[model samples]
Structures are given as C-alpha cells and as structure tokens.
Target: MAEKKEQPDASKDEPEQIVDPWRVVTTSEKGVDYDKLIRQFGSERIDDAMLKRFEEVTGHKPHRFLRRGIFFSHRELKNILDLYEAKKPFFLYTGRGPSSSSMHVGHLIPFIFTKWLQDVFDVPLVVQMTDDEKFLWRELETPDVARNLAYENAKDIISCGFHRDKTFIFSNIDYISSCAAFYKNMLKVEKLVTFNQVRGIFGFNESDAIGKISFPAIQATPSFSNSFPEIFGEAADVPCLIPCAIDQDPYFRMTRDVAPKLNYLKPALIHSTFFPALQGAQTKMSASDKTSSIFLTDTQEEIKNKINRYAYSGGGSTEAEHREKGGDCDVDISYQYLTFFLEDDDRLAKIKEEYSSGRMMTGELKRELVVVLQSLIGDIQEKRRAVTDDIRRHFMTPRKLNHKA
Candidate 1:
C-alpha cells in the first residue's frame, strides 16, 4: 500500500493576533475587527435613521465621511443636533497631540471633517495642540521639542482652510500660564479622577511618571467652556462637540463621567475610524515610520513609490488568478484610501464594481489613488506655503471669535 500523505498543520496558517483597539496599534498584518471594537468600546453606531436626522437638522447633506460610515461612532451626537435645532450655542473642540514636526495624510481626516462641521454649524472652533501631553507621552528630550512641533503642526492644521476669525488654536504649554480657569478646571477634573481610574482607563503602570497619570486631566479641562474664557466668556455654559478618532474616546469618557459632578455639559463626540497604514488596517499609520504613511511633505515620486511598494493588495497571486478571483476592496489599501479622498461617489462606486469584478487591475486602482492623493496633498502644500508667521499667529491668537450663526 502507498504511504499516507502527511497532513499539514492548520494552526500555522491562522492569521496574526489582532492589535488592541485601545492602544495606537501600529500596522498589524491582519486587520482589526471594527464590530468587536464598537461593542467593546460601548459606542453607538451611526445608522440610517441617525443619518437622516443629521441631514434634516443640519439643513445640508451629511458629509461623505458621515454617509460612508467613516465617522462611525458617537456619544450624545443627537444631543448636539438637538441643541443646534433649538438654536442653542455650542462650540467645536478637536485636538492634535503634536509629537512630530510634520503631519501625514492620515492627520488631515479629522481637521477636514471638523472644517466641514464648522462651516455647516457656523460655530467657533477651538483646536488644542497637546504639546504638554506629547512631551509626557512621547520620548522627547525637552518641552521645546513638543512646543516647536506644536507650531509646525498648527501650520498644517491652518492649511486646511479653517476660518481664522472663528478658529482658535492653542498649545497647552503656552496657554496654561495665560488662563487661570483652565488650571482650575484641570484641578477639578484631577480631583474627581482616581489613580486607579486612570490606570484602568489608560493601562498606566506604577513605573509611569506622575505627569503621565495627570495628563488626562489637562486634556479633559478643554471640554469645559470655562477653560477658554477668551472665546466663550467667563463662566459660559457653552457645550462642546469633539471630533476625534475612536481611540480617544477613553479620554472623553473619563471627561464625561466627571462632567456631571462639575455641573458642566458633557461634551458631545463624533469618532472616526483609524486611517489604515499603507500595508493594511490592522495598524494605525505611524508618523515616525516612513514606510507606513504618506506625509504632507512627501514628494510626488515618494507617494507613487510607496503606494506601489508597500500598499497591501487584495488581488490574487497571478494575473489570470486575479481575473478569476477578483480583488477584495475591503482589504485593499489603495481602494480604501480612494474611499476617503475621492469625493465623487458615483465614480468611486463604478471603480469599486470594476475592481471587484476583476475588470480593473490593482495597478490601475493604485494609479487612481496616487492621482487623487497627489492633487490633494499638492493643494495643501501650496496653501501651507502661504501660511506665514503672521498668518500662523492670527490662527493661534486667543482673541474673541466672530461666532455669529
């Protein structure tokens, strides 16, 4: 009798372990389960009914990000919409942790959508440059590194065409000394949040510095209107709407829990999905990892080369196999990038169908993405060049905003 064929071990072929959603998990070869994340995080889904209500109240079509489920989760978003419908005053609050001097394309997602929200709602926007947090969290040598990076990042944010008259950008290091109320609120929040609470929320260990343990209070202080008396008058009860990635929800969750005790309005939130690394959605795009992201400063050649070399493809191993099996757009990095940057819905749908049906090759799909990104990044670079020191100062100044609705 012929010898029995040896069986292969199935466990060896299993996918890589998924990255933890809580941490900024950098490029996992296998992608994350967003559904599992939603359940674990305990955030509500952005469903059809919510979308309809959003459009009805805003009196404008929901942004493509909202319609596409890119901004998929929220906490008390309807409350903000309800306040908007009632003509009650509320302000936009979103932030950047300035760990690097240059921002990548992934950094633009929140600012772009926040700009749209400001335009539609016609409200004042306060952008916090978390230099203090970055200094504590990142392996920076001095406060100056964080401060300088904050200014550079501010320029990138200003380049997104935010209204200087209605937008206020501030670095925590610079602004903390100027605002007494900010520190007061920070103290209040710190008092309310326990050591155990922060450790549980952030996974902080005993070895971590005291600054790291207390930094959440500083970030949380901005949620209260009292922290920014320059824009919203002293002791103003103005509510805030925070647009940030889902990973940041934990910070705001702690803030929300403490809000009622402080007699402050719980800041409403709209959370976006992470912009995937060039390799895949399994990891977040890292600013330090040159191979992982397309930076705003990247040359067109770099963008083209990176997309070709690193972007994970869903196409089959062989051309004939690809034609027979078709590409999976869900896992295709190029196709995913197009969904975010490509504004034309009909065109995107057509491309998706063609690519899915094996009519369009992976090269063609990536070529389309390269063009879209090049144009987008080029426009930003041109606008950023026009952002002089005076212009940057204009945006960063803490003067009263012309917040007329």
Candidate 2:
C-alpha cells in the first residue's frame, strides 16, 4: 500500500510551498526524513506490496538495497515493472558529475543497483558524465580539468563490472557537440521550463550565471530516447529508468514535467537515501574531503586507519557504560556502511544484534567494517587497474548495445 499524504491547499498562490524538501540546499542532522520527503516530493513509498510486485514481475528476488529500504522511495517504478512484465524494452540511465578524479564509496550505490537491473532485464544502459555541469558548478581553471575528471570518473564506473557490449558511457562535453538530437531535446526542455520554474525547482538566484540556470536541460536531455539515437533510433519510443540518490530528484522532476510536452515518456525513477559521511547522517560524503569517506583508490592500511580513527561510534564512552547502555545501530556509522556494502543479510543482522546488546565493543564493530570495506575496495582497485584508455574510449563511444530484447 502506498503511503498517502494530505493534499496541499490548491488556493495557495505558490504551490511549491506545499512541502519543504531538498531544493538547492540539503540539510539533515539526524538523517533525511523519508516519510516527509515522500510527501513533499509527491512520490510513493516502496512498500511491501510493491516489493512483491517487483519480484513477481522480474522472476528474481529484489536486490538488498530494495529489501532493506536503502532505496526507499520511487516515482512511477510500478509503471516500469508493468512494462517489464509485458516484455517491453526500456533502458537504464544513471550518471556522475565529473568533479573529482576518485569516487568515494557513497558514489557506488546507484551503479551497483543499476548493474543488477541491467543484468536482470537484459537492456542497454547509458552512463552520462556531466562534465559541462561540473564546469558550470565549480571553479575550474580550464575545460581540460572537467574533461580529465570525466575520464577518471569513467574509469571508476567501468570498474563497477558493467558489461562492455551492453553499456555506453558518454561525456557531455564531447557527446553534446556530436549529437544533434541531444541538443534538440535540450532546447525542447529549455523552452518548456521558464526561468521562474527553474528558480523554484533549483533555488537559483539572480547572482547565479545563465549556464547554471540552463544546465538542468543538459541533464534532462538524456531521459528521452532521441538523445541517443544510435542506441534508440530517432523516432523510437523507448523509455528510460533512472536510479539515483534522492538529492537528484529535483532535476528529474523537471525532466518528467517536460517529457510529455516533447512526445516522450516521463523517465521512471528509484530513489536511494544519501550515503552519510563518516562523521554522521546530517551530510553526504565529499570527494574534496579525503578524511570524510573511503575512496575507491584507498589502500588497505588507509581504510583500516580511517574506520578505526574516524568512523563515528555509537557506543558509550567507557567499557562499563557501553555494556550497560549498549550501542545505537541507528546512528552508528560502521553499521550504516555495512547496510550498503555487506551483502549477507544474516551476518548484518547478527552484527546489529551483538552491537546493540553491548555484546560487541565499539572497536570490534569498527574492525568488522574495516575488514569488509578493505576487501571490497581492494577488489575494485584491482579491477580499476585493468581499465585502460582504449577501454575507456570504447565505453565512451556512442553505439548500439548488444541487448537481448
């Protein structure tokens, strides 16, 4: 059953006032309020019934992210499932902003789940590197910085085990210039959305540059089939499913609003919660801050030290007090990281039980996480070493994927 919220008063002059959610600013001390965000974003919660529907349609058990509610909210995901049941073709679209050379662990959530979706559905997947977006948003000395970052980030994504024949990755700086359809779709979106609408959606102010104001269209263009005519023919009615963090919903919401106007399907979405920083749930991991997260390139010793020294513990200050009071699995950083990377459901549950009951000390809990993360990162680093420039070029080249149906 979808959780319903009271309808906002229609009489209000500004409907955006209906519910205060993440616009331009995202701030949460304890963690994001999923329930409040569901109401505010006008999306449905991914309830048990929906999960059952998903399994029945896919003929496979849902990924852990769904089972554990890591991906907690969605917009029109049921419609995508229905399409899948009918054996209709739909493509996967997910992206990264090229702001850094190395990706933190938090960056892997969507790609991990997206890879699973592609494996099951046997559909083509497109990964967009928004170098233009990074250029507009950040202070860079030259365009080369954004371009180099896009390639570097692509290497990390390529390390995620995406099927080369079935995956097509593109940098906006290159692809935007090469693809006319992309430009047309972007212009269509640019025309439909006004300056005020973008201001309302993205919290843009007069001080912001016009490039920033128009960048949403660049992101939005990928939602339509025409944007990648080589993969989906110019007139193809193929739709897209976007799996991303909830922070990105505002951009896609605008895309969905304009899709129908251009005679395209509104992109379906599955939203994941923010991967909290080592310190707490109030903020997300930053690539600029080396100490705040575990990067894909970190050594085993680096992972160990970061988890032991920096991972915020939820246990009491003293051993005796911890034994009496127990640890908080809810706010514990180590436990939260396990929920994302640790695949064994039973093991994770047991860890939670032991830690919460004070049977395990804080050092022991962090040690467990350290081991799990080190192994995961070590494997990725090994794979990333093999992703050569030629491989990167092949992935970046726009072409038809070897999709089965």
Candidate 3:
C-alpha cells in the first residue's frame, strides 16, 4: 500500500481578527488575543513591575482598570512618569466621537478612568468632541445635527465628575473657529503628512472624501501643547498622557511619527481593551445598534431584560449538563461586564469561583451583573439630569485650566 498523506487542519485557517477605529471582530469565543495585538501594534504590555513603579511614583493605588488588566497596553508611559517624578509639567488628552445622542455604558470606560487619573495627578485635561469626524463617517442629516449630538454627549461626559476648572471639553466645529492656535497646529500636521501617508495609516482609499483624508490632522493637533496656547502658554514641549481605548492608537501613532518633524513632544498613551458587545466578545458595542449595548438611557427594567435575553451565556444548554461540566467565565458576557463595573475584588473573585464551578447558575451570575449596571446607570442618569446648559458651557469654554503645566 502507498503511504497515507495527512491533510492540513482547516480550523487553523480562520479569518484574521480585525481591530481599528471603526470596527472590532474576532472568531474566538474568548475574544481578540490582546497579546497578539500588542505585538502587532508595537506597544508595550503593562506588567506588574510597571504597575508597582506607578504606585510608588504617584503614592496612590492604581485604578481597578489598571490592576485588573483592562487598561493593558501603553506607549512611552515611562516618560510621562519620569516627568511627574521630576515635578515637571504634563497634561492629559482624551476624546470621543459623537455618533449618537446618547452614549452606551461601554462609552464610560475611558472617562471614568481618566477622571481618576486627573484626580491623582492633579493635571489639566483636554477632551475633544469629534463632531466633524462623526458627520463625515455616519449617514447623519447634516453637520448641525452632528454638532447637536456632541452637545448631548458632552452632558454625559461632564456627569463623570471631572473638575470644570481642570478639564476643557470642546467640540471640533466650535473650537476650530474659536481657537487660532489649534487650527495652526492642524495645518502644520497636514502640510507634513502626504496623501499616501494617511491612506496607508488609516486604510483610506481614493473613493473616500477629502474631508475624511484631512481629519486625522485635526485629531493629531491636540497632542501638542501649543495647540492650546491659552492653557499651555506656547510651550510646545509640554507632553500629554492620553488615556483611551487601543483602537484609537492609529491616530496617535501617526501623531508620534509627526512630532519630531514638528519639533513637538510625542504624547504618551495608556490603552484600554475594547468593551465587548452584549451578544459576545466577537465585536464591540455600537451606538447605532440598540440590542448590542446597554445605553445610559436604558431603564432598570430594560437592563434586567437585556441581561436575561441577550447577554451571551457560556453555560451548558441543560442545567444538568452545566452542573456536570461547569460554566466558562471566559466567554460569558455577564461575568465580563462585572469585571469592569464591580469594584469589590473579593466579591468578584467569589462570583468567578462559584460560576466557574457551576455552583452558581447563569441566572444568578447575570442577576449580580444586572444589579451593578442598574445602580451605575441610575446614578449616571441622575448626574446627567443635573448638567444644565450653563454647566455644559463652562466645560466647553476655552479657558486656562488649573494646572502647573
């Protein structure tokens, strides 16, 4: 008989994971391999040594997100820490693109962590509302509609408890006109970067609009301190530490590349993992899809219903089978959400142990998550209701922030 030939395993040929500013997709039930992403994106992993150094430098325990590895990657973070140790000046920069009138709970991750950072470091913070980016990307009615969404979203952001004196939040449409220095830096970045450069960096093609091609420069301008001369006082060398999700890295990657050419300091970044959709870890939550996320505006009843009906369960199909095999917390959406919101470490650990051992049924695990989300969203709704037009204006205004930098 002839020698038998072995066929290759077809499962190994699964589609590549996709992660960018617009989308996140993965085939694995366990979610995107962040270690692969760190290697692909050329950013350093946040290890325990760095965390220890961070605590030593700041004299404060790291945020839950940091300790739990939710905020897992970084670029040039050590430089920012060194600046802080030397009593030198540095600020924070992070932003949001308003695609809808209301933000989902997933949208709160960066802001909640950034608020903690601002409190600990006592530094100035700048938040950009990218209304123009949304207008160009989404099928919105008009630029005015996008601008209105920005204002609505800003109210939610302000409710996160950022200090008005230390934080400056501005919409691109309004701020570009009011601030001359911001526009100047945008122009500087645009002049240096060619069509091919952005096309390669952002996956832009010939069919895309010129506005889309040029918008990266607007996002990049904030990395430089001189762009906010009123706040940083013409010192282009003053650095900034940006706390944002990993998907936002492409813009800052281009910003860092252009910094040396412009003689500006490169901004440091701390990247958080994506907030997975309710369905599963296969993708991120989308503002346009109501079923994919639990929005800030969702009622307590709605939250409970969503958790029961839609949140993906990693339990066995039958109660007897689940009890025999135990549940898998790795792919369970309810357990994943608790990791992000539930601050009590011991409680979370106990829940994990019980759920994984099949001692706690899926219903019980989800009920715990539902309670956490209900309380969190309820508190946010109350705070947002208190943010009047005047309060929003104060945060949006272009004024000197209260920071040594």
lDDT accuracy of residue 224 in candidate 3: 92
| C-alpha lDDT score of every prediction, in listed order | 0.87, 0.86, 0.91
Task: Name model 3 segments beyond 4 Å from true.
Answer: 1-15
Please report the candidate that would top lDDT against the real structure.
3
Tens-place lDDT digits, model 1, residues 1-405? 111122222344444333232365523444655565666667788899999999999889989899788999888899999999999889999999887889999999999999999999999999999998888878999998999999999999999999989999999999998888888899999999999998877888999999989998988888998898888778548989999988887888788888988889889889998899998887788888999989999999999999999999988778998899898998999999998999999999999999998989999999999999999999999999999989999888888998853
Clashing pairs in 3: none
TM-score per candidate, in order? 0.93, 0.94, 0.96
Better of 1 and 3 by lDDT: 3
Task: List model 3 lDDT by residue over 249-337, tens digit each.
Answer: 88888888889888888889999998899999999998989999999999999999999999999888999988988889999999999
lDDT of 3 at 198: 87
Query: What clash count goes with each model?
Result: 1, 0, 0
lDDT of 3 at 259: 90
Candidate order, lDDT descending? 3, 1, 2
Residue 118's lDDT within candidate 2 is 92
**Model 2, runs deviating above 4 Å:** 1-29
Which prediction has more favorable lDDT, 2 or 3? 3
Model 3's alpha-carbon lDDT is 0.91
